[model samples]
Target: MNDRSNARKEQRKKRYQRQMARQQKGSKRYQRTRLNVARIQRYRANCIKNMAHQVSHHLVADSTTMVVALEDLSLKNMTASAKGTVDQPGKQVRQKAGLNRSILQSGWGQLRQYLLYKTFQRGKLLVFVPPHNTSQECSRCGTIDKASRRHQSGFACTACGFTDNADRNAARVIARHAAYGLIRNKQPGQELSTVTLRPIPY
Candidate 1:
Protein backbone atom coordinates (compact mmCIF):
# COMPACT_ATOMS: atom_id res chain seq x y z
CA MET A 1 0.00 0.00 0.00
CA ASN A 2 2.84 2.37 0.80
CA ASP A 3 4.59 1.62 -2.52
CA ARG A 4 1.28 2.00 -4.41
CA SER A 5 0.67 5.39 -2.81
CA ASN A 6 4.20 6.52 -3.65
CA ALA A 7 3.72 5.50 -7.29
CA ARG A 8 0.48 7.46 -7.52
CA LYS A 9 2.13 10.53 -6.11
CA GLU A 10 5.02 10.18 -8.55
CA GLN A 11 2.65 9.82 -11.45
CA ARG A 12 0.70 12.91 -10.45
CA LYS A 13 3.90 14.88 -10.03
CA LYS A 14 5.06 13.89 -13.51
CA ARG A 15 1.67 14.84 -14.98
CA TYR A 16 1.80 18.27 -13.39
CA GLN A 17 5.33 18.77 -14.66
CA ARG A 18 4.19 17.98 -18.19
CA GLN A 19 1.29 20.40 -17.89
CA MET A 20 3.54 23.20 -16.65
CA ALA A 21 6.11 22.48 -19.35
CA ARG A 22 3.45 22.89 -22.04
CA GLN A 23 2.77 26.42 -20.81
CA GLN A 24 6.40 27.54 -20.98
CA LYS A 25 7.43 30.44 -23.19
CA GLY A 26 10.25 30.48 -25.69
CA SER A 27 13.72 31.78 -24.78
CA LYS A 28 14.61 35.48 -24.64
CA ARG A 29 16.38 35.08 -27.96
CA TYR A 30 12.96 34.25 -29.36
CA GLN A 31 11.45 37.49 -28.09
CA ARG A 32 9.78 37.90 -31.48
CA THR A 33 8.12 34.50 -31.08
CA ARG A 34 4.84 36.26 -30.41
CA LEU A 35 5.09 37.99 -33.78
CA ASN A 36 5.42 34.68 -35.57
CA VAL A 37 2.49 33.35 -33.59
CA ALA A 38 0.46 36.44 -34.34
CA ARG A 39 1.11 36.09 -38.06
CA ILE A 40 -0.10 32.52 -37.97
CA GLN A 41 -3.16 33.57 -35.99
CA ARG A 42 -3.86 36.31 -38.56
CA TYR A 43 -3.60 33.77 -41.35
CA ARG A 44 -6.05 31.48 -39.62
CA ALA A 45 -8.43 34.36 -38.98
CA ASN A 46 -8.34 35.35 -42.65
CA CYS A 47 -8.96 31.81 -43.79
CA ILE A 48 -11.93 31.40 -41.48
CA LYS A 49 -13.23 34.85 -42.41
CA ASN A 50 -13.02 34.04 -46.12
CA MET A 51 -14.82 30.78 -45.57
CA ALA A 52 -17.56 32.55 -43.61
CA HIS A 53 -17.89 35.14 -46.36
CA GLN A 54 -18.14 32.46 -49.01
CA VAL A 55 -20.72 30.50 -47.08
CA SER A 56 -22.77 33.55 -46.12
CA HIS A 57 -22.65 34.96 -49.66
CA HIS A 58 -23.59 31.63 -51.19
CA LEU A 59 -26.55 31.19 -48.88
CA VAL A 60 -27.80 34.74 -49.38
CA ALA A 61 -27.16 35.18 -53.13
CA ASP A 62 -29.29 32.16 -54.04
CA SER A 63 -32.36 33.25 -52.10
CA THR A 64 -34.76 36.13 -52.52
CA THR A 65 -35.29 38.31 -49.42
CA MET A 66 -32.34 36.70 -47.74
CA VAL A 67 -31.55 37.65 -44.18
CA VAL A 68 -28.34 36.49 -42.54
CA ALA A 69 -29.17 36.06 -38.90
CA LEU A 70 -26.13 35.95 -36.63
CA GLU A 71 -25.31 36.33 -32.95
CA ASP A 72 -24.32 39.57 -31.32
CA LEU A 73 -21.93 37.95 -28.82
CA SER A 74 -20.71 40.25 -26.11
CA LEU A 75 -16.98 40.67 -26.63
CA LYS A 76 -16.53 41.00 -22.91
CA ASN A 77 -18.20 37.68 -22.21
CA MET A 78 -16.47 36.12 -25.19
CA THR A 79 -13.08 36.92 -23.73
CA ALA A 80 -14.10 35.61 -20.35
CA SER A 81 -15.56 32.37 -21.69
CA ALA A 82 -12.43 31.90 -23.76
CA LYS A 83 -10.36 31.96 -20.60
CA GLY A 84 -12.40 29.85 -18.19
CA THR A 85 -16.01 29.37 -17.21
CA VAL A 86 -16.77 31.32 -14.05
CA ASP A 87 -17.68 28.34 -11.89
CA GLN A 88 -15.85 25.26 -13.07
CA PRO A 89 -12.37 23.89 -12.34
CA GLY A 90 -12.80 21.44 -15.19
CA LYS A 91 -12.85 24.41 -17.51
CA GLN A 92 -9.41 25.38 -16.30
CA VAL A 93 -8.27 21.82 -16.85
CA ARG A 94 -9.81 21.96 -20.32
CA GLN A 95 -7.90 25.19 -20.90
CA LYS A 96 -4.73 23.34 -20.01
CA ALA A 97 -5.81 20.74 -22.55
CA GLY A 98 -5.90 23.31 -25.42
CA LEU A 99 -9.60 24.27 -25.68
CA ASN A 100 -9.13 27.79 -24.35
CA ARG A 101 -6.66 29.06 -26.96
CA SER A 102 -8.85 27.85 -29.80
CA ILE A 103 -11.65 30.01 -28.50
CA LEU A 104 -9.35 33.01 -28.41
CA GLN A 105 -7.82 32.22 -31.80
CA SER A 106 -11.21 31.73 -33.50
CA GLY A 107 -11.76 35.48 -34.00
CA TRP A 108 -15.53 35.14 -34.31
CA GLY A 109 -16.07 38.88 -34.43
CA GLN A 110 -13.66 39.21 -37.34
CA LEU A 111 -15.45 36.46 -39.23
CA ARG A 112 -18.74 38.26 -38.63
CA GLN A 113 -17.24 41.46 -39.96
CA TYR A 114 -16.13 39.75 -43.14
CA LEU A 115 -19.49 38.08 -43.52
CA LEU A 116 -21.30 41.36 -43.04
CA TYR A 117 -19.55 43.09 -45.95
CA LYS A 118 -19.81 40.06 -48.19
CA THR A 119 -23.54 39.75 -47.57
CA PHE A 120 -23.99 43.41 -48.41
CA GLN A 121 -22.07 42.96 -51.66
CA ARG A 122 -24.57 40.30 -52.67
CA GLY A 123 -27.42 42.64 -51.82
CA LYS A 124 -28.46 40.65 -48.79
CA LEU A 125 -29.15 41.93 -45.31
CA LEU A 126 -27.06 40.55 -42.47
CA VAL A 127 -28.68 40.75 -39.09
CA PHE A 128 -27.15 40.42 -35.63
CA VAL A 129 -29.32 39.11 -32.79
CA PRO A 130 -28.78 39.28 -29.07
CA PRO A 131 -27.44 35.95 -27.81
CA HIS A 132 -29.19 35.28 -24.55
CA ASN A 133 -30.50 31.72 -24.51
CA THR A 134 -29.90 30.72 -28.09
CA SER A 135 -28.57 27.36 -27.05
CA GLN A 136 -31.20 26.67 -24.44
CA GLU A 137 -34.32 27.92 -26.25
CA CYS A 138 -36.08 25.37 -28.35
CA SER A 139 -37.01 26.67 -31.78
CA ARG A 140 -39.86 24.22 -32.35
CA CYS A 141 -41.50 24.71 -28.96
CA GLY A 142 -40.02 27.87 -27.45
CA THR A 143 -38.65 26.10 -24.39
CA ILE A 144 -36.02 28.05 -22.51
CA ASP A 145 -33.90 26.23 -19.94
CA LYS A 146 -30.33 25.08 -19.39
CA ALA A 147 -31.09 21.37 -19.47
CA SER A 148 -32.42 21.47 -23.02
CA ARG A 149 -29.01 21.09 -24.57
CA ARG A 150 -27.26 17.76 -24.48
CA HIS A 151 -24.12 19.23 -25.94
CA GLN A 152 -22.94 22.18 -27.96
CA SER A 153 -24.56 20.74 -31.07
CA GLY A 154 -27.69 19.14 -29.69
CA PHE A 155 -30.78 20.70 -28.14
CA ALA A 156 -33.54 18.67 -26.52
CA CYS A 157 -36.39 20.60 -24.97
CA THR A 158 -38.40 19.35 -22.04
CA ALA A 159 -41.31 21.75 -22.38
CA CYS A 160 -42.37 20.37 -25.75
CA GLY A 161 -39.83 17.58 -26.21
CA PHE A 162 -38.43 19.38 -29.22
CA THR A 163 -35.10 18.03 -30.34
CA ASP A 164 -32.96 19.75 -32.94
CA ASN A 165 -29.40 20.39 -33.88
CA ALA A 166 -27.93 23.01 -31.52
CA ASP A 167 -26.48 25.20 -34.25
CA ARG A 168 -29.76 25.07 -36.16
CA ASN A 169 -31.67 25.99 -33.03
CA ALA A 170 -29.34 28.90 -32.44
CA ALA A 171 -29.89 30.06 -36.00
CA ARG A 172 -33.62 29.90 -35.46
CA VAL A 173 -33.35 31.93 -32.26
CA ILE A 174 -31.14 34.42 -34.08
CA ALA A 175 -33.75 34.74 -36.80
CA ARG A 176 -36.34 35.43 -34.13
CA HIS A 177 -34.08 38.08 -32.67
CA ALA A 178 -33.49 39.56 -36.12
CA ALA A 179 -37.23 39.97 -36.51
CA TYR A 180 -37.14 41.96 -33.30
CA GLY A 181 -34.87 44.61 -34.92
CA LEU A 182 -31.90 43.77 -32.76
CA ILE A 183 -29.44 44.32 -35.57
CA ARG A 184 -30.65 47.84 -36.14
CA ASN A 185 -30.52 48.90 -32.53
CA LYS A 186 -27.07 49.65 -31.18
CA GLN A 187 -25.95 49.38 -27.61
CA PRO A 188 -25.22 52.90 -26.37
CA GLY A 189 -21.62 52.89 -27.64
CA GLN A 190 -20.85 50.04 -29.97
CA GLU A 191 -19.19 50.38 -33.36
CA LEU A 192 -21.35 47.64 -34.81
CA SER A 193 -24.31 49.77 -33.79
CA THR A 194 -22.94 52.43 -36.14
CA VAL A 195 -22.37 50.04 -39.03
CA THR A 196 -23.94 50.79 -42.41
CA LEU A 197 -23.60 49.20 -45.78
CA ARG A 198 -21.96 50.95 -48.72
CA PRO A 199 -23.46 50.59 -52.21
CA ILE A 200 -22.59 47.25 -53.69
CA PRO A 201 -20.19 47.41 -56.57
CA TYR A 202 -21.90 46.94 -59.88
Candidate 2:
Protein backbone atom coordinates (compact mmCIF):
# COMPACT_ATOMS: atom_id res chain seq x y z
CA MET A 1 0.00 0.00 0.00
CA ASN A 2 1.07 3.63 -0.54
CA ASP A 3 2.25 5.68 2.46
CA ARG A 4 -1.02 7.70 2.71
CA SER A 5 -3.27 4.62 2.48
CA ASN A 6 -1.07 2.79 5.01
CA ALA A 7 -1.38 5.72 7.49
CA ARG A 8 -5.18 5.84 7.11
CA LYS A 9 -5.48 2.12 7.70
CA GLU A 10 -3.30 2.40 10.80
CA GLN A 11 -5.53 5.18 12.20
CA ARG A 12 -8.70 3.10 11.67
CA LYS A 13 -7.00 0.05 13.19
CA LYS A 14 -6.09 2.10 16.29
CA ARG A 15 -9.63 3.47 16.58
CA TYR A 16 -11.31 0.07 16.34
CA GLN A 17 -8.79 -1.34 18.82
CA ARG A 18 -9.50 1.52 21.30
CA GLN A 19 -13.25 1.04 20.94
CA MET A 20 -12.86 -2.62 21.72
CA ALA A 21 -10.66 -1.86 24.73
CA ARG A 22 -13.27 0.58 26.03
CA GLN A 23 -15.88 -2.10 25.66
CA GLN A 24 -13.68 -4.51 27.60
CA LYS A 25 -12.62 -2.25 30.48
CA GLY A 26 -16.14 -1.04 31.34
CA SER A 27 -14.54 1.63 33.50
CA LYS A 28 -15.33 5.14 34.72
CA ARG A 29 -13.96 6.79 31.55
CA TYR A 30 -16.28 4.69 29.49
CA GLN A 31 -19.23 5.64 31.69
CA ARG A 32 -18.27 9.32 31.61
CA THR A 33 -17.97 9.31 27.83
CA ARG A 34 -21.37 7.70 27.54
CA LEU A 35 -22.79 10.39 29.82
CA ASN A 36 -21.20 13.08 27.69
CA VAL A 37 -22.64 11.47 24.57
CA ALA A 38 -26.08 11.72 26.22
CA ARG A 39 -25.73 15.49 26.19
CA ILE A 40 -26.82 15.49 22.54
CA GLN A 41 -30.05 13.81 23.63
CA ARG A 42 -30.59 16.38 26.36
CA TYR A 43 -30.17 19.34 24.02
CA ARG A 44 -32.52 17.83 21.42
CA ALA A 45 -35.10 17.19 24.15
CA ASN A 46 -35.04 20.83 25.26
CA CYS A 47 -35.58 22.02 21.69
CA ILE A 48 -38.58 19.74 21.20
CA LYS A 49 -40.27 21.15 24.35
CA ASN A 50 -39.75 24.72 23.20
CA MET A 51 -41.24 24.09 19.75
CA ALA A 52 -44.20 22.16 21.17
CA HIS A 53 -44.93 25.08 23.47
CA GLN A 54 -44.83 27.59 20.65
CA VAL A 55 -46.98 25.49 18.32
CA SER A 56 -49.49 24.39 20.95
CA HIS A 57 -49.76 27.89 22.38
CA HIS A 58 -50.52 29.29 18.94
CA LEU A 59 -53.05 26.53 18.27
CA VAL A 60 -54.85 27.08 21.59
CA ALA A 61 -54.91 30.88 21.24
CA ASP A 62 -56.24 30.77 17.68
CA SER A 63 -58.85 28.07 18.21
CA THR A 64 -62.37 28.68 19.49
CA THR A 65 -62.29 25.79 21.93
CA MET A 66 -59.94 26.35 24.85
CA VAL A 67 -59.39 22.67 25.50
CA VAL A 68 -55.94 21.54 24.35
CA ALA A 69 -55.51 17.83 23.75
CA LEU A 70 -52.14 16.10 23.61
CA GLU A 71 -51.15 12.58 22.63
CA ASP A 72 -49.37 10.52 25.27
CA LEU A 73 -46.10 9.55 23.64
CA SER A 74 -44.35 8.40 26.80
CA LEU A 75 -44.38 4.92 25.35
CA LYS A 76 -42.97 5.64 21.94
CA ASN A 77 -43.35 3.11 19.13
CA MET A 78 -43.08 4.77 15.70
CA THR A 79 -40.25 7.28 15.56
CA ALA A 80 -37.78 4.67 16.76
CA SER A 81 -38.35 2.74 13.54
CA ALA A 82 -36.82 5.39 11.23
CA LYS A 83 -33.42 3.88 10.56
CA GLY A 84 -31.95 3.22 7.12
CA THR A 85 -28.62 3.74 5.45
CA VAL A 86 -27.07 3.48 2.02
CA ASP A 87 -24.04 1.34 1.26
CA GLN A 88 -20.77 3.00 2.17
CA PRO A 89 -17.26 1.65 2.84
CA GLY A 90 -14.18 2.51 4.93
CA LYS A 91 -15.80 5.26 7.05
CA GLN A 92 -17.29 5.77 10.48
CA VAL A 93 -20.93 5.25 9.54
CA ARG A 94 -23.31 6.70 12.11
CA GLN A 95 -27.01 5.93 11.76
CA LYS A 96 -27.95 9.46 12.78
CA ALA A 97 -25.31 11.06 10.61
CA GLY A 98 -27.39 12.25 7.63
CA LEU A 99 -30.63 12.68 9.54
CA ASN A 100 -32.36 16.08 9.60
CA ARG A 101 -31.06 16.43 13.15
CA SER A 102 -32.17 20.02 13.54
CA ILE A 103 -35.77 19.40 12.52
CA LEU A 104 -36.10 16.38 14.80
CA GLN A 105 -34.22 18.25 17.52
CA SER A 106 -36.97 20.90 17.82
CA GLY A 107 -38.17 19.21 21.05
CA TRP A 108 -41.75 17.94 21.25
CA GLY A 109 -41.50 17.61 25.03
CA GLN A 110 -40.52 21.26 25.40
CA LEU A 111 -43.41 22.22 23.13
CA ARG A 112 -45.79 20.24 25.33
CA GLN A 113 -44.46 22.01 28.39
CA TYR A 114 -45.06 25.36 26.71
CA LEU A 115 -48.61 24.31 25.86
CA LEU A 116 -49.34 23.27 29.44
CA TYR A 117 -48.05 26.52 30.89
CA LYS A 118 -49.72 28.69 28.27
CA THR A 119 -53.07 26.96 28.76
CA PHE A 120 -52.80 27.36 32.50
CA GLN A 121 -51.79 30.99 32.06
CA ARG A 122 -54.80 31.53 29.82
CA GLY A 123 -57.12 29.61 32.18
CA LYS A 124 -57.80 26.92 29.61
CA LEU A 125 -57.99 23.17 29.98
CA LEU A 126 -55.30 20.86 28.54
CA VAL A 127 -55.82 17.13 28.44
CA PHE A 128 -53.95 13.96 27.42
CA VAL A 129 -55.28 10.56 26.41
CA PRO A 130 -53.87 7.29 25.10
CA PRO A 131 -52.44 7.56 21.57
CA HIS A 132 -53.63 4.19 20.22
CA ASN A 133 -56.07 4.20 17.24
CA THR A 134 -55.88 8.00 16.91
CA SER A 135 -54.19 7.72 13.53
CA GLN A 136 -56.20 4.67 12.53
CA GLU A 137 -59.62 5.87 13.76
CA CYS A 138 -61.82 8.02 11.53
CA SER A 139 -62.36 11.53 12.84
CA ARG A 140 -65.79 12.02 11.29
CA CYS A 141 -67.40 8.66 12.06
CA GLY A 142 -65.14 7.37 14.87
CA THR A 143 -63.94 4.33 12.95
CA ILE A 144 -60.87 2.37 14.05
CA ASP A 145 -58.91 0.07 11.77
CA LYS A 146 -55.36 -1.13 11.37
CA ALA A 147 -55.59 -0.59 7.60
CA SER A 148 -56.66 3.04 7.87
CA ARG A 149 -53.12 4.30 7.56
CA ARG A 150 -52.53 3.90 3.83
CA HIS A 151 -49.20 5.65 4.23
CA GLN A 152 -47.11 7.31 6.90
CA SER A 153 -48.21 10.94 6.38
CA GLY A 154 -51.93 10.35 5.80
CA PHE A 155 -55.01 8.61 7.14
CA ALA A 156 -58.00 7.37 5.09
CA CYS A 157 -60.89 5.46 6.65
CA THR A 158 -62.21 2.52 4.66
CA ALA A 159 -65.36 2.06 6.75
CA CYS A 160 -66.73 5.62 6.71
CA GLY A 161 -64.80 7.14 3.79
CA PHE A 162 -63.44 9.86 6.11
CA THR A 163 -60.12 11.45 5.34
CA ASP A 164 -57.83 13.88 7.20
CA ASN A 165 -54.42 14.52 8.68
CA ALA A 166 -53.05 11.81 10.97
CA ASP A 167 -52.18 14.21 13.75
CA ARG A 168 -55.59 15.90 13.46
CA ASN A 169 -57.33 12.55 13.67
CA ALA A 170 -55.39 11.72 16.84
CA ALA A 171 -56.08 15.19 18.23
CA ARG A 172 -59.83 14.73 17.68
CA VAL A 173 -59.75 11.41 19.50
CA ILE A 174 -57.86 13.00 22.41
CA ALA A 175 -60.48 15.74 22.51
CA ARG A 176 -63.30 13.22 22.58
CA HIS A 177 -61.62 11.30 25.39
CA ALA A 178 -61.12 14.58 27.28
CA ALA A 179 -64.76 15.57 26.86
CA TYR A 180 -65.93 12.21 28.10
CA GLY A 181 -63.90 12.81 31.24
CA LEU A 182 -65.48 16.24 31.80
CA ILE A 183 -69.06 14.95 31.57
CA ARG A 184 -68.37 12.15 34.04
CA ASN A 185 -65.41 11.38 36.24
CA LYS A 186 -64.81 8.15 34.29
CA GLN A 187 -63.88 8.38 30.62
CA PRO A 188 -65.67 6.16 28.12
CA GLY A 189 -64.11 2.72 27.82
CA GLN A 190 -66.01 1.41 24.79
CA GLU A 191 -64.39 1.13 21.39
CA LEU A 192 -65.08 3.71 18.61
CA SER A 193 -67.41 2.67 15.79
CA THR A 194 -67.53 4.02 12.24
CA VAL A 195 -71.22 3.66 11.43
CA THR A 196 -72.46 4.27 14.96
CA LEU A 197 -70.36 6.19 17.49
CA ARG A 198 -71.62 5.06 20.87
CA PRO A 199 -69.95 6.94 23.77
CA ILE A 200 -70.05 10.60 22.74
CA PRO A 201 -72.00 10.41 19.48
CA TYR A 202 -69.39 11.62 17.04
Over 4 Å off in model 2, which ranges? Answer: 1-50, 75-104, 186-202
Q: For candidate 1, write residues 1-202 as lDDT tens digits.
A: 1335435644655554554456556655343444544554465556656655665555556555456666776666655555555476454565444543443345456557776787778776777666788778887777789988867668889899878777777777767767557445657776542323221110
Query: Residue 143 error for model 2, in Å?
Result: 1.9
Residue pairs clashing, model 1: none
- Score every model by TM-score: 0.58, 0.53
lDDT, candidates in the order shown: 0.61, 0.58
Q: Write the per-residue lDDT of candidate 2 for residues 111-196, one digit (tens) a residue.
A: 56676788788877667767677768787788789898887668888998788777667667767766665555644795532221
RMSD of 1: 11.7
Candidate 2, residue 5: the lDDT equals 47
